[model samples]
Target: MQLTSTIQKLHERAPRLGKALSLATATGVITGNSIGASIPIWFMGAAKTITGAKIADDTVIKVTNYWINSNNALIDNILPNKDWRINLPDDVHSKGKYLLISNHQSWVDTSIVQYVSEKRLPLTRFFTKFELIYIPVIGQAFYFLDFPMMRRHSKEAVAKNPALQGKDIEEAKRACALLKSKPFTLLNYLEGTRFTKAKHTKQQSPYSHLLKPRAGGLALAINALGEDIDGILDMTIVYPDG
Candidate 1:
């Protein structure tokens, strides 16, 4: 009873505590990840200066993976009980290239996925709306890392400009090409958005845990990078206690 009461009190005060923890962790991860990411650039720069040859894709991946692993370690230490899990095949690490098709249930899902994949797998990058690219630090990083940002248009706009209809698809292909040139994991959430009670009731979702999977995004990914992908990483995340 006392424990329950204490937990209730913590819940009541969770917002403030969560905000502080998130800020502190974010500061540490961003700073660490930035420095970590720069190490590879530095190495490549020195290699180019000394050897007069561009760093190989495999070598760049190894260097970046080191930083990503360090970032994941920091994340794991901070959120030990966050209920994040990565479900991939036994040969997944051996086959570093993957297409992770997952169901989105919360805003936290991406962070959880990235946190889990940091070092264990390759860096998980996503296709996002172009507007996100204008968002200061995030945009800069996305641009630097060649993250795909699509400009979504209305039906009328597409109808008027037929050329624009397939632009997003083309952009996705380009992004996949960049990943294929190296070794990386592509993260695709088939559900599109987090599952909410309102959305669930609207869609009449078949599963208690997930909505009906959307195929367009996943299809585009498979079609564009099908040959390069080692296999599908079908991940399912469950948070039993909300």
Candidate 2:
């Protein structure tokens, strides 16, 4: 609380320095938390793979929950106050399975999802590119946590090599299957990419605010986990400043 007040006061006094300090503080905290949580996750992930141990699987998720809670704490205590209006169904539970679809606008959208979902929903996982595995702790943590990883093929590449066609879909299905046994909140950005005016212009989007949603990913998720999912959730986020 004192730190938050100090930072806010500093911002009022010198905006640039305060902004820099805020970024530095957030980056350091998140980085340290990720690294610390990832070590146990990696070892437990390996154990789960090797032994098919439920304890290992549970431990990984427990650690991940702690990691998220730490970040949520940072948001509550360290960041500036704002009018954060979050509405979730009363029936939603941490042990329920759900498919969450949302508009893609900026990187902060994912963080917002985390913020709203801390204890109200099951652990949130999203589709990630397979190439992200090469990135350090966070990427590997995604794999450990069973976040679906996709290998998307461009139309041109698929056209040139017909063998590549449908491979990504098959891989995505396999990834989704990994979550069938556990409670989860799977997030899919229906827009497929971040929304931009240039992209909106190029696509000649019909909607005033959103890009034309690509339904294939949602279809794939349903085909893979339809029976287990409790509900399909649609979340709309509005940024007043944007």
Candidate 3:
């Protein structure tokens, strides 16, 4: 671990070092996640993009999943609590195609999904915005993983331009069609974004801890994938200390 020496030194020199140790570990995790993993993943993804073979794309997906697993392992190492209790179905098959739906909270939700579904679901990919391709590293990685990149058209815009009415769904279908060749899990956050107190109040959400669920995104997924989707996995997550 990169922070091990520094944390030990801080513990030796500082009277109150608990927070310092935690901070160092957190820093290390961030550095390792971004640098130790994402940089290489970016280049590998670029290589995957250049190739025209399905086998190459599958290989890239496997690598990305391994990257997620590595990050999950590191996070577990950094956390003080080792026991995470979540009820996942016993029938969830590793080789089956799945649509995983969950509530979004903090940025940590991605990692939580990766950790919980690691061995249970086929390495999960999330539906991303089409504009995310403009981002540097993460965009490239997501593209390499072949996650469906949705191009959303506003209702008003679609009404004004009749030609664009079903364009978004067609693009989604094209983007998601790649998953048909392999068994994979795609995660969709039903709320469409992270949950927040302001958003909840504004939406007048019915759920106690969740924002109002947006059916449009799920509809897009269903329309795009048709009957290719194997099954659904619904999850509820909570952070007690929040």
Q: Evaluated with lDDT, which candidate comes out highest?
A: 2
Task: Judge candidate 2 against the unseen true structure and give its global Cα lDDT, from 0 to 1.
Answer: 0.90
Candidate 2 residue pairs that clash: none
Candidate 3, residue 14: lDDT: 70
Candidate 2 Cα misplacement greater than 4 A, ranges: 154-163
lDDT of 1 by residue, 138-241 (tens): 55456445566777888999999888887887887777676666566788888888888888889998888777788887788788887888888888777778
Candidate 3 per-residue lDDT, tens place, 1-242, comes to 55445554555567367556676767776666666556666666666667766666666666677777877766665444346888877788778988888899999888888888888788888888889988866787778778888788998998999899888778777777878778888888999889999999999999988998887767777776778888878888888887
Top candidate by TM-score: 2
Number of backbone collisions per candidate, in order? Answer: 0, 0, 0
Order of quality (lDDT): 2, 3, 1
Write the candidate numbers in order of decreasing TM-score: 2, 3, 1
The ten-residue window of minimal lDDT in model 3 covers: 74-83
**What is the C-alpha lDDT profile of model 2 across 90-127, one tens digit per residue?**
99999999999999899999999988999899999998
Give the RMSD in angstroms, all C-alphas superposed, for model 1: 6.0
- Residue 40 C-alpha lDDT in model 1: 64
Instruction: State model 1's lDDT.
Output: 0.69
